[model samples]
Target chain A: MPVTLKDVAQKLDLSITTVSRALAGYSDVAAATRQRVLSTAEEMGYVPNVTARHLRQQRTDTIGFIIPSEGPRFSDPFFNELMAGLGNEAAAHEFDVLVSIHVPGVEEEAAYRRMVYGRRVDGVVIVRIRHDDWRIRFLQQEAFPFVCFGRSEVPGDYPYIGVDGTLGMYLLTRHFIESGHQRIAYIAAPPHFFFATDRKAGFRQALAEAGIPLEKELEILGDLTQQGGYLAMKELLSRFPSADTKPTAIAACNDLMALGAMAAIQDAGLDVGEDIAVGGFDDIPPAAHSHPPLTTVRQPIYQIGAQVMRTLVQLVQHEPLAQRHIVLEPELVIRKSG
Target chain B: MPVTLKDVAQKLDLSITTVSRALAGYSDVAAATRQRVLSTAEEMGYVPNVTARHLRQQRTDTIGFIIPSEGPRFSDPFFNELMAGLGNEAAAHEFDVLVSIHVPGVEEEAAYRRMVYGRRVDGVVIVRIRHDDWRIRFLQQEAFPFVCFGRSEVPGDYPYIGVDGTLGMYLLTRHFIESGHQRIAYIAAPPHFFFATDRKAGFRQALAEAGIPLEKELEILGDLTQQGGYLAMKELLSRFPSADTKPTAIAACNDLMALGAMAAIQDAGLDVGEDIAVGGFDDIPPAAHSHPPLTTVRQPIYQIGAQVMRTLVQLVQHEPLAQRHIVLEPELVIRKSG
Candidate 1:
């Protein structure tokens, strides 16, 4: 026979409402009462039928993580690590992690339909946001409790979290400059994504602060992939002379691109960190093991995911969140590449 | 005013059921009928109120995938690739993928609770099963339709897809022998997982066929992570000296272990290929880039996931399944380490 709340209440000699609240994980329940109810339930192997209870409570205890397949972020390893971190944190917080993938349609409505309608995940964690993204507008209008992995230009009152890409990029560029490098090439991602714009901003800011003029010829928007960086390097080598025109330093938007840059440099008969210095962002596990190692920024993606869950918990608990968007700074992990 | 389904149906001169079925992605709808209904809905500028629909349907259209924290199989790069593949397939099939982290108290029962009680997900995909897994029995008793990523010892009519670990280990072991490695040690994961047993069976089978005696001291079983493998490798080195008891070749259960073995060999002041040729299964991307380029089995994990979802579609549709258990063959990718 399925155990009911009344049976648990009778066994514990407590009122039905008290047993119900304890089972529902209500805060008003005394700690001893909650413990007794939990222990008795465990001993009796009581599994509450939550569907009916959830219908009444309007709480599902699940967080939906939406992975947008707009750019090549889906194929990258950074997203995978972030997912793992989120999975662990969600488990600790007694929440389920729902990962939904939606392809970029002609508009953002289709993507919204996938998450908001068909799936109906509790709260959402939106990754890979674009500049002037309709997703932000849709989420804002709905008043949905969500955290964005990337920031937007027109920031709103949404409690969001993301890496400080501008500062990370500036630090990397400054490190290259201090390492006796000039004419540094910046291999960036597409401007559609917010990170690309922020990274570009940092590069420009660092160059300006160093009293060095920005060279439009040295900046190429790569797709934040090794293949993209390789193609960009090829174009760089072809358009300019090896010694006179080719930049002495290269800062890629990601580790994959930095590795690609290294491959290109070696193929061009130039040694990395000697003939040419190279750096990347998102200091992945392999960043330290790469050929001559890679100088990159550690995004603390795992911690970001942990924080995202913690923040969502606060939101779910109806606690006040920060008015301004919380931006976590990235650290520079220097290695042989620089 | 919100656009209603009935209003859209009346506007299109179609039955409410037909309009509803077309919107819900029922394949039986005529293409012309679907296109007409969709265009009419677009003209009406309808956005589905998921909260209302969820209240009625008692569903989220999200299937949970449970990854056990006990095994290395759950958190590896190959696991990520499998997830990506599954995500793509799930999206194509119009289902959201929910990942639940497996813990002791919050085990597989939590998944069923979320699906049936909380109405968080419709179905589940269970990976890394032991012989006496409670998840299998619970789902079986509940008559819940689920697909196993790996098969069990006592299978009965439930849909299961598996990678042929026996054949994979046989091939890797054969490679080691052919490369003049007579004494080979098997560094594997914990003995509880089905794959570990299957892999051990194949290892013994190959050695018995080659007329090599099976030494109990040669096989070491531990955790599946790189750190786990590193610790196990250190223990193996301490137990077996390089001068006498050392095996010329070591067959690691997975690429993470293979990488760890390489590190262990280098830490022991020994060359990887020259002193101890190491091989691992699961040709993860890093296997190709690792120092000395790990030789490993290239299991089409993405294809496996795709196949599992495709098979689950049959179950969901109540179609005749061609096979109860579908086993995929593993490809041997020979690299410099072997």
Candidate 2:
């Protein structure tokens, strides 16, 4: 026979409401009382039923994170940091978070469709928004509570938390210019992703301010990947008409691509800093340990998750968000690469 | 005004069970039927009571993944692979997995203690067992169902899935001996870790069988870090005092340390393939991309999580497990490092 909540309350000589609040991890419950209820419940082997199942607690007490179905190789360092932060906060809230990856290649749409409809996550946190994002649209129409890591270029009045990529790129490009580089290159992603576009805007804006003419050949456009950068760098060097004035420095949109560009430069028998200074964005884990210890933009990756979670929780609880668009600053971390 | 399951059933002219199952994503229902239920529910603006406060169907449907609170720097290729694998499985099951980090200098043990005691998880998955692991012991004595990433050294009664590190090291060391490297060095972690101790034992066993004398100078111990490996290499090179016959090969227990050791060798102006061979265990993502790709022992990090989950699901269902100790094999991958 399954032990009932009533049985627990009766056994503990307490009211059912106290037992209920304590069992649910409610913050309002007194710590000592909650502990007693929890211990008693565990002792009784009481498994609370999730919404539709009898295995877990009545409330899912779970948050969901959805990463756009980006390619497998395209998994960003940003995701890892954000996840670590979300995990940290969720644990503190005694809430479990579920992360769903919608790989762009196979059945991307189906994953989100299932999560929103069936998985019925308590709230959802979406990262890496692209232009014409169906996800933002879905969340808006569905009125599902969500928080975005990077706001959509075509945002629809949904609560979002975004990092200042524009400022980050501006700072990175300024660093390269200050390091005594005249003709600079930008290893950027295509103008599809909002993040890519914003970063490019920042790059071009900084260069324009410095009175440098932006050349099409200098803007090495490719997917946001090291291999893409490697291949792009090869094409940039070979395809460019002028050999005498090769860009003295190249700034990558992300660290992985920066590393790849470095490899290509090294393969071409050019020193990274001596021949051409290289810089990257997203000061990922490998940024610190790279052969040259890459100089890049350092965004508070972990804090973003915590803030996003807190924001999502607020949305779920019908609390007023003082601001919808929460922007975190990206600091420039200079190393041997720049 | 609340849209109860009964209200939903009446509106759809279907039984309450059919309506419930369809919303719950049960396989018994037809796809079209499930679709209809979802569409209707969405139209009704129905949000399931995640707290499970009022609804009898409040099952959280969330799975708790207790990430070994170890930081990213401490993790090599093994933990990352496990996470990737776990992510795939968790997504497929339509369940969210929670992640938490345990920073070393920060509140490491207390962080874990809080997460578990807080009743945040339905079921916990533990990674990397320590010698006096309070978490494992707590789960065991309390009969809390858990799956460990590595087996406990003090074996004989715990549910765990892990690779045979001792056997893996023995094979790799035997390969080194066969390749005509009699004087070998093992760049490994502190002796406290079970994997390190087991690997050292394997190294010793291989040396004994090959009739090679064991030398203390050939053993380098430090933290499981790249810098640690680099520092260890510097120490081994300076203090060995045997300039005539230095170690011909070095095997790090993991890839990060191996890469560091490789860097250290380069800093020492020694050729990798020509002068000395270096290898590591648990083939990390960057291992393949290193200047000379590292040879390593490949553990099935992904399958470990899936298999552990499968085993855990069985435990949750009260199904009989064939064995409490699930031992996996580690394969030797030959690369440029060795």
Candidate 3:
């Protein structure tokens, strides 16, 4: 059997309560006694029962992030970067990050309930907020400390840090118009996502402001994947077989799709920038080095990750937040592709 | 205060020992008594004290994977895929995966110690083995159950699943030679990695069999990153100012570097497949969609991940294994670039 609190207390000739308090980092215990107790416990191979400690203290010292995965595999670099950012910052704060990857459905809901009702985490960071996110409602009902990477349409008082996707898309579309492209097209993400709705709205608003009539044929939906973009672009191309009728510029909701669009253009024996200007949102690492390079809207995902964690930490500590809702500006980056 | 075991027992008019055993899912408890205890606990909002239960069972139902990350942000899709595989498989087995991202050194060592000594996880899955991986030694000393994604130079009786990197490299090199290329260059990963040594040895072996002279200038070391590959390729180009002296083919250690090399080659006013045959390892998703596509060696990373977890679960349960050392074959996929 492993060494226990009782074993340590007996070895040190101290009370069990005193030894427990010392190891718990409670200031009520003498500093020298705490040191001796810690060293002896380490020497004796005393592994702390974390579940017990968490039960008594009502804190796990761990933050949780449940990936809103849709399928069997998730390969989005955006999440990878965000996770790295969260993990690094959480580690710096002496906290561990517990990541639960589950497709959004019954399993996902059960995961949230288990983590919250079981007291498995101190707090959580929610991402990929839907139009009517049930998680926010559940978390709020439980009075749980949590923060969102994206905001939901559901009315609630909660902390969130969101990139201004609508404005970013507006800026990108405006840049395309300024480049003397009257016929422009947009490849959008599935319409249910909050960012997808916001970004498409921005695109439409820009076209209306520019006195360019919105063409129903030009706006196509993509599954926010490279293959989805490729198929959407091909469909868009098929609608206008002639150079005079086709859109001179295309804007995708993400860089991966934009890169795919570029490939589609190349496959059609057309020069990317000269024949068809293409741009994407979220200047992922590959955008800068893509063939002919890609113009995109840059979101500070790393900083957003750090900020989200800081807010969640504040909420966990029951500290007052100066501003619960943070909207960071997105930057427009013009390159050879657009 | 929240409801406790005593409160549930008093409410049900039952003994505390019966209530505890029922909640613990012990078969000794009568089915009817367990049902009554569960319903009462749920009605009273009695969240099971996981810590106390863990203390009695000596299990956390969690597996750990510490990423040997070496930078501010890690964006490799390889790890993302592997993580998805591990997470999905572990979830199927009613286990949670706890990931810790830390660079290899003092902090990483401390993380292992903490996870092991704190009883935070039941077992671990190790990745990215090096020439002298200290993690293996440490885990062995603790007698902790672990399964490795890669093997270390330090031989030991441990469970591991490794890809045949040496044979894969030899095949790739031989393919280049069969295409009538005498001056083939290689962009290798950091020398400290065990795969790097094995792959480079294969490259040398292939050239020796072909009766080709080995040129020290043709071998370059990259940091297993796109930027590293870009810089290494640039350096390789600088060595040969004339077209006649430059290498006719190039092989990168991974797809990211290979893509970077392709970009560098394009920037130098040269066609990828025609001017210089370019290939990479790992067959990452982008490799197939890259401009001109990339020839690569494919390692079944997803399967490898699932297999690693299976072996780990077996070890954790102290079950007998048919074979502990599993070496999976790597396939050479020929694309336009090579």
Candidate 4:
């Protein structure tokens, strides 16, 4: 049986209210009384009822992370690394990470509402921001504490840490243009994502700088998955039946898609890094291990996850932040693929 | 401002106690009064205080999962897939999944204690069972609800869902033996893990049936990481300086280690499929995409995660479980690596 506050108070011959207040570190209790209460509680193996204490303090000491996923089949290494960062940091601070998976719509909103209105968590960490994200708006409206991994286009200030996708894509695209490749293609993520829009702008910026006209046929939208990238590349190849009319280079918004594009290229009897230069973003673990390897834009995903969690904690505690909005620079990693 | 029970009672012209009892669905409350209270509360947008309700009901409606990890650097796609399954199913049932990462030892024990005694979670899902696991013992002694992913060596009846590692390894090892490879090596996981012990037994069982004497030098222990596998393979190669004396076939306990062994083989100027055959377990997503692809034992990790959670929920609710203990068969997936 677990020791309760009443049991401890009875053993110490003190009032239950006094023992509770002393254990809670309320200054109204004498210093010696507080010390005595702590020692007695420890000796009795008294583990405080966290739910009861949280109700009194109006704090759960939990961080919520609602994964915006398609379904149960969602498997992204990026989320794995990010979750490790968030969970590790939260655990270090004696906070539990409460997680749920919901698509970005009514269900997702309800999950967030439950966490906020029900006081299930102290704060939340938001990822994969969409254009004019309603999550941000809802959190802001409720005055709920949260930190985002990406920024939204909504005209409001919020705390966030985002990678410079536009700059990352620009660097990769510029590398292909400088390599004397005039016929370059890009596989993009869904346009609903904010990073997708930024990345596409970077691709165009590089093409415009080289005085190359943007070809609608060269740009394809993918679902940010391996299969999606494979189908998009197959469609691009089918549009140009002849070898000479095929793209000389392809840039994927993510590593999974890039890997799929590489597979499609190989199936088409085109050698990667020779017939078609391929590059990707978010330098995941497999990026370095792929055949011929992959040239990619590197972002510190784990670090960002950790930082976002730290910021959310600070926000929950009403502490002043060092920076409200941070945009991190992405680095280009040169490999055999590009 | 959030609507409260007091406001609902006042609007409905009922006593606070009556309103509360009616909202709680107490049998003593009159049916017409209950209907009026419910309609008034719904119209007023009254979101009940979950913490207060949980305190009264003695239920948290939260499942705990403590990830046994090295640190923030831990990146495993297997966990990612499992988490997706756990989180998705839990959300469908309106339960939140509480997560924390801790190395196995005192810190991990404290995490479990806090979740149990502090009433932070209604039930816990235990993974990566160690031999004679103390966690199971503690939870059992406390009479807390828990479902394990693997069984401990400790003699007791417990609810668990485990993959048959012994059979999985036996089949892989037998395949190598039939392929005319006498000089086969096995990279084992740490001995403390239950699956590691089972897998090693299977490896030895296959060798014994073939009348091959167990060579201590041919079996190496790996930390179940890519780096660990790489270093173990390097040590195995260093032991036998000549190509003829080195292992012609290698089997790693997990895919990460197998991939590392493949890298080491390539570094030694040996072709993977032609010169040295490699096999791995777990058949993670990277297994299929790996260079030369990995021949591995496939366990439905995502489904297992879902099943574990479902069983845990049933345990917590005191519902009759369909199966108390389940041992699933693992399938052998052959690819180019072998």
Whose TM-score is greatest here? 4
* Ten-residue region with minimum lDDT total, candidate 1 chain B: B67-76
State the lDDT at B245 in candidate 3.
91
Report iRMS (Å) of candidate 4: 1.4
Name every residue pair that clashes in candidate 4. none
lDDT of 3 by residue, A1-338 (tens): 45779999999999999988888899999899999999998899887766667767788888888987767777676777788878878888878888888988999998887788777788999988888788898898888989999767878888898888999999999999999999999999887788899899889999999999999999999877788889989999999998799999999998889988998998888889999999998888778888889999998777788888888887898889999998888999999999
Residue A198, candidate 4: Cα error in Å is 0.9
Q: Candidate 1, residues A1-338: lDDT per residue as tens digits?
A: 35667888899999989988898799999999899999997777666654445545566677877676545224556766678778888877878787766557643356565455433556777766788877778777767677777688755777678889999999999998888777899998888888888888888888999988988999987877677787888787777785777798999988878877787887787878888888999887667656567899888777777778778867876888764377888999998888
Point to the candidate with the largest lDDT: 4
Best-first order by lDDT: 4, 3, 1, 2
Per residue, candidate 2 scores C-alpha lDDT tens digits across B64-132 of: 665554444333445556766666666665545656566543455554444444444445687766776
Which one wins on DockQ?
Answer: 4
* Model 2 Cα lDDT, one tens digit per residue, A98-174: 76666763466665555565434667887777788777887777777788888676657887777788899999898
- Model 4, range B1-338, lDDT digits (tens) per residue? 56778899889888989999998789999999999999888888788777887887889999999999854488877788788878877877788899988888899999998999998899999998898899999898888999999767777778999889999999999999999989889999999999999998889999999998899999999998787888999899898888788888998999989998888887887888889999999988778877678999998888899999999988998999999999999999999899
TM-score of chain B of each: 0.86, 0.84, 0.93, 0.93
* Model 4 TM-score, all chains together: 0.96
lDDT of 3 by residue, B1-338 (tens): 44678999999999999998898899999999999999999899887655566666788878998988857677777787788878888878877788889988899988998788777888999998888788888788788889999766777898899888888888899999999999999999998888888888878888999999999999999988888888989999999988899999998888889999999999999999999999898888788888888999998777888888888877887889879999878999999999
DockQ of 4: 0.76
lDDT of 3 at A292: 85
**What clash pairs does model 1 have?**
A51-B117
